[model samples]
Target chain A: MKKSFHLFYIFIVSISIVVLPSCTKQKGCTDNTATNYDSEAEEDDGSCTYNAETDVEIHFSSMVGTESLVYNQEYTINGRKVKFTRAQFYVSEIHLHQADGDLVHLEDKYLLVHGEEHAYSIGKVASEHYHGISFSVGLDSAANHSDPSTYAADHALSSLDPNYTHWNWNSGYVFIRLEGYVDTTAAANGDADFGFFYHVGFDEFKRDIDLDISQDLVGSTAEIGLEIDFAKFFLGVDMRTENSTHSMDNMMLAEKIADNADDAISAE
Target chain B: MLTMQFQLSKNINRLTNAGVIPAFVSFFLLLSSCGKDELISDTAYNLEIPKGFPAMDIPLDNQLTVQRVALGKKLFFDNILSRDSSVSCASCHLPEYGFSDPEQFSKGVEGRSGFRQSMTLTNVAYNTLFFWDGGATSLELQLLAPIENPGEMDMNMPELIERLSNNHEYPSLFREAYDREIDPFTITRALAAYERTLISGNSRYDKYMYHEKNDALTESEKRGLEVFNSSRTNCSQCHSGFNFTSFGFENNGLYEYFADSGRARVTTLHSDVGLFKIPTLRNIGVTAPYMHDGSLTTLEQVIEHYQAGGKLHENKSPLITGFQLTTQEKTDLLNFLNSLTDYEFISQTAE
Candidate 1:
């Protein structure tokens, strides 16, 4: 009877040792630097916040070197004059890399850049002292090759409303679209308006750009100026031989345009 | 065994704390005493998710119940839903033919032919669009189309309601399925619920790929899988994923010009003139007379069309760049396509 009682006591102790700690563990923000960090927390509750979120706006300044881009107006590039009709690109995965080695990712940071809707309202980010703001040129690979129609109507990748940036046949997005009439007739700058429609795509052609931009958010919203040189888009490229790429089959040409897209943006 | 005993003891302690064991026993006893005419319990139906299928997004308001699915199945097979009570949903969408018509275009109640071919309903729960033209966004909405169509059942809404209300079984069925009287919302909801249950994932390819059944596929079928997935062929560009369709519209170069504007009529986009929704390749062996217009009669002819590279067809997608296939490769690809036929799904007897 004595031996049996001791065995029962040992079994109860073992069970308590196994399960009691888990039951008693308090959950809260465990990060020490976070505003809501609890010193007594043993489990992370995902309520960690470094500071209050401040709204940030990113505005694009579309230009051709010294000349500002005007729709349907002529611009000289590589001694070839061209009239720009429509120019658009996607910017995504925007982040703020802090000096403290911590990173803050902007939620839903997909920006559709066009002449009309050039500015991107990069939603709220924690108001913390940061070294620089970094963002990518195109959508992340996760969002690539996915059915955009699956998303809600007002979603960034939705195929409804303001028209989709994706292709119907290839089941991929056109990362950048440049359409206009280029001077393809002459040796230098020509008079004839031979049309050019360049639609660049492919996940392999997706580029990332890290801009060393510093901003101090004293107010609720911060406006950051972004500039894209449309002239540099067709550098070291002849428009005469290869004008249109609606198919997105030319990998070599797509790579060139993708490389140029990295240098396309500047912190204005 | 020791842990199981300990768990049982812990559960007993919990039950003792709640003190509801007697109530639970009495509840079951009361349930057992009820007859068939009594109110059926509304326990959420256990929808079986096949190996390759994702969790379905069932609407919160219209939760699936055993009675609802049973009612839907009964309604689907019944001719009373038709105007003249001569045809049912099963007339066009035959189960033996993978829920598709054997004919090029399924005939209506008046024996008049339709424009497009009947699309296979295999794994249709995962579809983004409900129709070839994507006229209806949801399955619930699409159910009304066939019922109201002049060439289809031709039963108007008012007449349908009147007929359903008059039917002795329908009122009780609706009450059991939806806890309400006969209504349009309940009718559509029940139909959609039953249709979503028509899942098929037990194909030889699914067994081989998901269940790791190596012997499920033949050597020719294995080699054919390689050809189908090959970059040279580019078949997987559109006809990809577990469902064998990305559920997107594309102009696959069926003809130089289309007699019937498939998606273009719905969207009113000039560029979308010849485009139609890509049907699932599941049960492809049985579901033919193929394509939107059902122009191609056999799988061999469809393969030949892709092999020829849609050269004559102007609106063909640029991805349809022709590929050279040897006689062996062609046979292998066909074998792979045949491997998608789910025998278990076609022969299913249970609701």
Candidate 2:
């Protein structure tokens, strides 16, 4: 009787291990094709086809005719003139919002773009015909403070060039960098106005800008264009003569640039 | 009797032929039903909450319960999550020093050193954002960072799930904390739920702000509040609100060449070059060596740094140009900053 009891226990345990796993296995491996965890909770009726072709592009705009460039053209820096000739910034957290409010946010939302060009694109998004596109003008809250090495990726924008965006190091990416030559022809001071740059990131208060592309798109694919008005940047400030004396070392103009978020964008 | 015995034997043989024994099948069915029936509750697990704190903002997707918090606490302290099982979250952030590592920068797995100081978790529940740069908007999302960070715990998400799922206590704990399942999201949420309960609202500054208690703070501290609120100091412009931080990034005149562009790196803008997020002043006395870069050593030096309006001038904030403060005012401000410290937070234990 004792021998039979031992066999009985072993048999039951073994059967439980084998049969139970197979029973659960019938639910199948949750492939990457399944919608996000949030959708699964809603018991996604499979009505929304997970199979879709998607493409995304990030655009940049630079000053049109201003060749030599101007610094603090918008404000004074270190009691001198400043100009912004070069600028590169980041746009991240690209999320596709469905008509039902369900969102498909990409794991890697980091995109590095320069104003000298038009846009950059993340190829073949999951939902091409997204209801609306929501993205941050800068890094999202999570990635902003995370360690740089933790964000390692083979094809990440930071990986492409370490100097441009400061990747694989401590702190987050420089969301935007503006650089250019200062117009020093009319300067009263003999300060050289060449090689001026405006580097902005975590400081600027307007780090989080939400663009509602819902109105821009007609279907799954939409060309979300943002016309950066370079003229509006230097409205109240003068960079030409100021560049002779002022430079990046003087953060006053940088603060003005940091505070100058309202004057930066428009719908092209 | 012969007919009954023959029927029973025949039935048993029939079951055996179908790849199951009668008793084995019966036990498996019973156990499976019991496992399914042992569904975890969706509500947040119970953790001890101190008085004078607000209800934590836990994500709906990840509810906290007592068992889940326990599991999260264990995971939080477990060095097994590291690549070499050497360091854990608590390694840099100890419970004793208000969760901040004593070292300015922590040593990570494989004896690698981190770049920044380990921030304290005092009154972190009310934080508008996490990390010095405000990178993670939610706690749930923030939990994934340190675990996977190459300089930190250095563990992969898949391996973490596998290890936890195999543990005897975790399967049911996962089922209890999350309904009947174990996955990455559930684990992240549970851990986040546990962290959200860390509140530091009982500081002397909090009492003075809310009540008219005259003795809540010293006279020097009160004078410090005056200087901090005064225009000459201009501290309140960025450090405003009850949280004592505007939670926005600023240049703070830390560097000129932009070794770290700070928030500008995330936004990719030229104007944000030297800026960094404004860290909260709650428990400021204990959590420093100050600034995003940990450049200043003491509160006096920090105040002095601000008094001098910082070193870098190009694109420096207009608010940061020298305050020319009197020695008395400087002393007052430092006292006020020290008053923000809350000692009770580090003492609390998991109930």
Best by TM-score: 2
- Give the per-residue lDDT of model 2 (tens digit) for A178-243: 666554555435443566555554533234444445442334554666656554444555665333
> How big is the RMSD of model 1?
14.3
Candidate 2's C-alpha runs over 4 A off are A1-268, B1-56, B349-351
Q: B300 in model 2: Cα distance from truth in Å?
A: 0.9
Q: At residue B136, what lDDT does model 2 achieve? A: 64
The best candidate by lDDT is 1
Evaluated at residue A19, the lDDT of candidate 2 is 48
Please name the candidate that would achieve the greatest DockQ relative to the true structure: 2
Off by over 4 Å in 1: A1-268, B1-40, B311-314, B349-351
